[model samples]
Target: MAEIVLANVSKSYGAVPVIEDVSLAIGSGEFVVFLGPSGSGKSTLLRMIAGLETIDSGTLTIGGQRCEQLPPGQRGVAMVFQNYAIYPHMTVRENMAFGLRNINLPQAEIASRVADAARILEIGALLDRRPAELSGGQRQRVAIGRAIVKEPRAFLFDEPLSNLDAALRVRTRVELAELHQRLRSTMIYVTHDQTEAMTLADRIVILNERRIEQIGTPLEVYMRPVSRFVASFVGSPAMNFLEVDVSRRGAERLVTLPSGAALPVPIDLPNDGRYELGVRPENLRVVPSGGDLVGEAVIIERLGDRTLIHVRLADGRSLTAQDSGRSNVAPGDRVALGIDRAEMHLFDASGRAWHPAQAQAVRATETA
Candidate 1:
């Protein structure tokens, strides 16, 4: 019963608030990721859960026991840090056994725990090596092994893969996922990398400016973002924003772009002032002739299998569209982008997002 809950938990550094009125429940044996850019307080939130930082205004409970005022060791959570916090002066075995030794556990139990963790992390062969002698990935595994010996209720990881090389990072990320499946332990990982969050977490908690913007499964957040900030931040190339006017003409709901091109998007709106049309690069297609949107190719990014075309619209704003690797479209070439209504997202002045399906459902309900 390692379920964790935070009820109106918040933290502040003087007058500056880091985490404010955040409440969430993490099911036992679930893998959750805190994702956001630097200074967004993802790590701070994780630290709060770890008891390294004091909670300012709310209560935290781990496995149904209040832990906000508890010491980190008493909170029933183990943390693996970005810096492999394992002692460099000690061998891998010694580093993994250090915490157990501090508690004056039976020498046999300490040795058994250390041996089991090493075997689980596949570092049993390197148990006698110091941190300097081991590779970055191996050292990180040692750090994790140190945490595993505690048999805590949950695990906390703060950008543990950041120090590894790109290839190694990918490899280690997969290893972590496998390890989670093996242990089925409640793990809360903190990372700014969306790729890591998308691939690793069962659910992602997206934070921005010291506040949580959204929390959902990867596909849910990717397919249906709640706000413009979320839509823009979650994807690789990010969502494109085009200023447009929404108005009702007869029975047709139209979105008039800056270039006077109208997209017939039948969605519920006030049809007042300017709104932002959100579309992803993959949703926009480069057509041969006239399309829903017209633009000129200003940049062509050629990856191995795909080419990304940066289309500069008539209004001077640019958008990224995907094309095949063999695409002959060059810079300065005239191109038009086609988009489907179902794939489009509309954002009001307040930055709230609405999809075609959601809007139609709302309209149907209103008319009913």
Candidate 2:
């Protein structure tokens, strides 16, 4: 296992920039995932690390060695691609041994490595079968097994589970996590799926528009996003945002919504200005009596475990709240909703985040 580092890394095709000034350090034996939208440069960054794409500027270091200029073979990294690139006519054993054979390793050594990889991947039983006869998940395992037999210093995966069905994807995800645990090698995985990123990564790198937005554990980003973009991008139902005006209510600051309901926020304002208030669906509760906000339920979606309520506020802004699945709330009900003061998020005019202490202060003064 080795550490990977990128300093001021960038990529471009003529005048169009794909990635820009991205710097990150991946610890040795750590699993890092690059997550973003389709055009967000996640794949481009992965390719740069694998030496498939040239870095227009910046430095890349792998295992304490400068590797930006090295060829893919000399970089000591093995890649598992999305297509499960296996020769259909060759048996799994022959497929896994092909790379080693090209380098002219001793016959005994090649057999030992292939056998060890097949055993590790639990593909020893199917070693003699051709790729045409294997299931999607099994074929992917073969691709990974091929990488393992190379005995690389690190592993790079580019959407390796995309071809599998939903059930197979989950199973393969678990297997990949176990493989990392057993090998304890540095692995960089790229995927556009947020669920995959949340479940698989030790730390997630969120990229957007040729730049990185934030890098943190899944819960950290979900609980306290540093920007409005991250707050909206990281959550499943996405965060709810409403525009409000800030005002001084006695010694404390309060945010008055367009609906004329004033919410005590825990933040200090330089002046009465416009800002966006963010709340997660789980943080908003349906109240039996009264609340600081009132809205009409526009839609209700009931999942097995939870119910999602989409409420259109008096001012015509919409917000969603999550309730217990067993709770019977129908569409078109006039529902009162309360915000959990401790779980609120406030953003400045520029979309940058404010500390929670500010939000707490506002809530305290309002309650007082």
Q: Model 1 lDDT vs. the true structure?
A: 0.91
Off by over 4 Å in 1: 360-368
lDDT of 2 at 238: 87
Tens-place lDDT per residue, model 2, 266-300, is 66655678888889999988888688688898899
lDDT of 1 at 199: 100
- List TM-scores for all candidates, in order: 0.96, 0.94
- Candidate 2: lDDT of 196? 86
**lDDT for model 2, on a 0 to 1 scale?**
0.90
Q: lDDT tens digits, residues 119-182, model 1?
A: 8899999999999999999999999999999999999999999999999999999999999999
**Could you tell me the lDDT of residue 52 within candidate 1?**
92
Residue 279 lDDT in candidate 1: 91
Give the clashing pairs for model 1. none
How many steric clashes between backbone atoms does each model show?
0, 6
